[model samples]
Target: MQRLLVALLAAFDAAIAAAVGLVVLLAPLTLLWTLAFGITADWGALWPLTGTLWEFGHGVPLAVTIPDELLVALAIPAQAASFAVSITPLAFLLFTLLFAARSGARAAAAGTWLLGVLSGTVVFTAISTAVALTARLDAAQTPLLLAIVLPAAVYFVGALCGAVRVAWEEGDGGILDRLHDRLDVHEDWAPVPAAVVRGAAFALVGVVGTAALALAVMTLFRGGEVVALFQASRVDALGATVMTLAQLVYLPTLIVWAASWLAGPGFAVGVGTAVSPAGTQLGVVPGVPVFGLLPENSSMWMLIVVLVPIAAGAFAGWAVRSRLVWEGTPLGTAQRAVIAVGIAVVTAGVGGIAAVLANGSMGPGRLSEVGPAALPFMLALGLEVLVGAAILLLSPRHRDELAEERTDRWIAEMSELEPSQAPVVPVPGIPLPRAHDQAFDDTAPLDDVRGFRPPTGNRD
Candidate 1:
């Protein structure tokens, strides 16, 4: 009964997530459609447009084709008339992942994480299937199979991660518990997996934070350039609003590019352009307002930005080490080494995935290659992080750290003892009271000191 309830609730959560994403797309689109073409406009195209965009936002690439009449009227080059828009907005996908994660956490709390994740994924996939089947656009077409699978995959992965994270800390009384027990048998390696995961999470957070800070600094310094581009576009209020919203949605994509820059590989704005801290090499580039953030020139000294990821890795290692000490589960040098490597590997994997999502065609011609190359970014970040983590994790244990661990262990042991079972400590020339002696009640009134007498007991 409990499992069934959890599954049902999870399915409900999945439906809400999908519905909310659709509504978000539909609402603004509805207003825009009405304002642009009035009630006489083809309302049938709205749902298809919304659905196609939703699919695109989930990382599905669209094969965009300009209508023959529009192309001829606009005098667009034949080569530029059709192109693939693979760079996803990522906002919708992010929303779904976060909602699914929340639902999975709830399910883990309910003690049915696996069932909840499976049920939620099944429902999400069904919704995706319906959307794929119904949403057909003559201008923008997405792969049917990809449209059905990608969103569901995103939800599934997010839910599994969230559920496992919670269950790992608070036993799920099933598979996780058994796995934990098995890991426990090997004391040295017991904390390795959890520590690695924790450290990797910390590293990713640090990288993202640094990337965001860099983006903010760029915005502050380059605000005028962005504004200039926006003004040069000469867009009306609605177009401007739409442009702003689009930029906002692509913020995460920009952050990923910034991270790649910090990692030293940088990213490409077009086929032959390179925007890196080391140097900025380019020819003609798109005039998107966000592109204004790109540095026109770079100095060799700017390569020092690569240190950012290293610092993040070092911070992760310190955090993991502190946690291990706090928990009285100090690992051996080999175990720490494995943890450091694991942190690097995990960080690299995440970086690679982000690069894959962020690096895709933005338009026809030179715009075909945009964002960072996944392999370079991953290898660079992994190596840099490994160096930093190794510096912390592979180093000899400090005396202070060992002393703190011992102190914590002692305190925990003492805390577990009953009052009567607590051992007494004696000071030189000061006898300790015996445990069997009558205990004084703090609530009772104190008697006069003049009439007070010592109990008859050992004085030594």
Candidate 2:
């Protein structure tokens, strides 16, 4: 496990990842386009498309400029049409994440995770630089710095996560593990970690569940429209398959949009569109099948759906409260409140990040602006969960209730362990006696210690 060898393997892993992702994107596309459109352009021309998609998947924006000649054919008087396309499918990112994680975990086990992550990032940055420099397609432009930095960022995050995960579990004695040990010493900070972690999980589940339910309802109500749009595409099974697969890749992004919707901010498919319960106001949307799920015109009653995020927050708060109640000792009410808010803050930060990733341009013009506002979504979501959690955590726990819980827990533990005493005896006429009770005589004659004579033998 030499540092140099670890670095090399990490780079090799990244290279293989990129190669496989490109192949997956290009192979099916090549076959489908050739069959469907007779490959009007040379096979080499498709490389730029693949390259552009690669950059897109890394969350890089593409500047598209239309040629002047097309304007005349389309009877348009616009001088020069230029717009940015920023819709990232996330499939490439997901693939790289998994690959880099594997590489980093292996490197961490070898005690060279730093070198491994650095090497992979360096290679990825270099590859991205080359692609940005040479992969322009038909007047399309890639941001030079973003192209170099974005993919490397993704790789760095993935590698760091993987390395830390393994390092944490295996006790690699690395700086990360050392810092973790140091942090674990702070009693004041102990409850924060559990509350934050559990709260985040709870919020994630709640928000995602809300989205799923909404999506299901949409599918049921607007099933015909979705089907009609699919039929209108007039594509053969192969084309439909490709389209379906592409949509599947953006599923997580859609879920994020749904979360935004549930949070009351809603999301836009295009610039002027706002699909919220406040009432849907939309223009002509693109022919994406998922767009068919939009309600024609939402009623004012629909605005009540904002409760979804509030409910999600409450769920998260409840989770944090439960964890603190079970695992925590007596703390000041202020401290408990602080712990609950801390969890909300962490979850809000995560939500904001998701909003940022989910919100981006789909294509030129109106389609460019889409998805939720990050700051607003975070604040709204955080406040909701925080309110519910604070109410529960800061409330006084009755001593009786606490005692009952402890007693129940103790009984459960006792039931689980092997008993040290003999087995209980079962009597036909009476209830089975416990081993402890069997050792004592309940009906024995007692001697008086107050000088009064007690019968040595039973009167019976």
Candidate 3:
């Protein structure tokens, strides 16, 4: 009965999540439509546009074809009439991922994570299928299969990841428990998986934090340039508002680009453009206000920014090592090395995924090849992180660390000892002469006490 309840709740949660995403899109687009078209608006197109965009936001690529009339009116080139837009605005995707994770965590807490996750995924899949079937945009079309699968896959993956994390930590009394028992047999190796994941999480947070900081600094210094671009665009208040909102949605994507730049691979604005700390090369780039944040030039010395990611990795290693010491599970050198490698791999994998979602076409022609190349960015970041993690993880233990370990061991030993088994200090034996065994009467004590030495020395 409880399991069934959990599944029902999970399905409800999934439905709410899907509705919320659609509403967010629908709200803004509705206002724009009403303002532009007034009473004569083609209200039928609203749902389709919102659904298609929601799908696209979840990483489904859209084939955008300009209408013949609009193309002719705008004098657009025939070659640029249609193009694919695959670079996703990560904000919506992140929202869904986080929400699903929360739901999965709740399910795990309810003691039936598998059922909950499956229920949530099934509901989400149904919604995606309905959207694909009903939301048909003649101008911007998505693959029917991809439209159905991508969003569902995103939710499933997120839910699975969240459930597994909770189950592993809290013991699900099932598969995770069995796996944990197996690991317990090899005490030295048991912590490797958790430590690696922890370290990787730390490293990713550090890298993202640094990227955000860098972006902030750029915005501060280049605020005027961004404003100038906004002015040059000559957009009215509503258009500017929409543009600003669009850019905000892409902030995470921009942060990924910044991280890639810090990693040394940089990214591209066009076919032959490069935006890296090492240098900058460009020709006829788009005049988007966000693009104004790009550096017009860079010195070779700027390449030192690569150290930021390495430092992040080193911090991760330190964190994991500290945890090991605290838990009294000091691993061997080989195990630690594996941990370092694992941290790097995880960080690289995450970075690569971000790169994939952040890179692709924004428009036609030269704009198609935008953002970082995933392979180069991943390899560079992984190698750099590996170097940093190895420095901390594989290094010899310090004197302080050894002392801490000894202290922990002592505490453990003391805690394990029973009261009866506790050691007692022995007192040394001292010999004493037996007292006189006589019972002299109190009445005759003054004259004949045992061995009486009466007033001999001090009497005079």
Which candidate tops lDDT? 3
Query: Per-residue lDDT of 1-460 in model 2, one digit per residue for the tens?
Result: 4888889999998788777877887887788778777847477767878787788887887887778888778765473377777767666777888888988899899987888888987887787777777777876778888877888788888888788778766767678777767767976665565566677678778888889787888789998998888898898898788778888877777777788878777878787788887878999888878788887787888778777766776777766666555663445676677777886787788888778877887766688888887888888778876776676667778786488678867777768765544345543334444556655633322342234464588676
Instruction: Sort all candidates by TM-score, best to worst.
Output: 3, 1, 2
Tens-digit lDDT track of model 1 for 1-460: 9999999999999999999999999999999999889999999999999999999989899999999899999999988988999998878888988999999999999999999999999999999999999999999999999999999999998899999999999999999999999999988888899999999999999999999999999999999999999999899998888899889989998999999999999999999899998899988877888889999999999999999999999999999998888788888889999999999999999999999999999999999999999999999999999988899898889999989878988998989987667665543443455545613321222353345565888778
Clashing pairs in 3: none
For model 1, state the Cα shift of residue 302 in Å. Answer: 0.3
Q: Please tell me which model should have the higher TM-score, number 1 or number 2.
A: 1
Q: Model 1: what TM-score?
A: 0.91
Clash statistics: count for each candidate: 0, 1, 0
**Segments of candidate 3 deviating more than 4 angstroms:** 418-421, 425-460
Pairs in steric clash, model 2: 313-385
- Model 3 agreement with the true structure over 1-460: per-residue lDDT tens digits: 9999999999998999999999999999999989888979999999999999999999999999999899999999999999998899999999999989999999998889999999999999999999999999999999999999999999998889889889989989888899999999998888999999999999999999999999999999999999999999999988898899899989999999999999999999989999999899999989899999999999999999999999999999999999999888888999999999999999999999999999999899899999999999999999999988999999999999999999988988978986545444432332222234222221233443455554656554
Q: So what's the TM-score on candidate 3?
A: 0.91
lDDT of 1: 0.92
